[model samples]
Target: MLRRISFYVVIILFFLGGCSDEHGTSPTSFEYEALPAPGNFEITSGSYSLTLSWDYSPENIALAKEFFVYVVDPYQYGGNIYPVDTLTVAEYNTSKGCTFDKLAANMEFCFVVSAVDLSGIEGRRAEAECGTTSAP
Candidate 1:
């Protein structure tokens, strides 16, 4: 029984050792370098809607694969934010913005946009922009 238990332990140790890379780090471990945040974030208000826009430099544009848009209700959530939409580079270039419609009129919403690379890693978020929807 002692020998059997020792053999099982050795097998488990071997399997665990195999799970690491040559660098002695686990295979699941990764090093990430975050991209720069989007710039010139602006918001435009419309009746029951709001549009969020941002800018990126030529180098950043080349690095970014998509943009993640987040929204928050300052009054309700006390500044808690969540992602609402994602825009591909092509889609954003075409419209120059993303619109969220069917919102409560005359209500304020805050937004932040972040650039994501092809590997689906998101970078820092831009400064928040807030706007109130036009009265219906």
Candidate 2:
């Protein structure tokens, strides 16, 4: 009886330990390098307003997850980090790449992307990031 119980316990432990999550995490993003810059990046359609788009390269982009673009207004004095209000697309587009549906016409904004990792240890920031949201 005792032997049977121990065997079952060991098997359960092994199964639990071997389980792998869909999203794998890298211990430290220090080694993770940026993708060779975003492709098909550009300023998309607007009411002559500010719009930005890119491939949003992430160092460790695991399956079943993706990045969210952000914008930073360095001139506005909000530090040097911000999430882009507009632009949402998983795969990169060849022509427009990504698009900001609507925005304040003639406004200024800078944009970037951060990976929403499942592990939640660190936010995946892109190195090929760029922005030019200057007031028009």
Task: Tell me, by lDDT, which candidate is best.
Answer: 1
What shift in Å separates residue 135 of candidate 2 from its native position after superposition?
A: 13
Q: Write the per-residue lDDT of candidate 2 for residues 1-136, one digit (tens) a residue.
A: 9999999999999999889686767676556433233445556445544455555434444421445566665576544776554222346323334555445555555566554444443354544334333334
Worst 10 residues of 1 by lDDT: 21-30
TM-score of each: 0.72, 0.41
lDDT of 1 by residue, 1-136 (tens): 9999999999999999999766764678677888898888999999999988888887877888999998875767457778899999999889877999999999888998999987888999887889999976
Q: CA lDDT of each candidate?
A: 0.88, 0.51
- Model 2: worst 10 consecutive residues (lDDT sum): 86-95
lDDT accuracy of residue 5 in candidate 2: 100
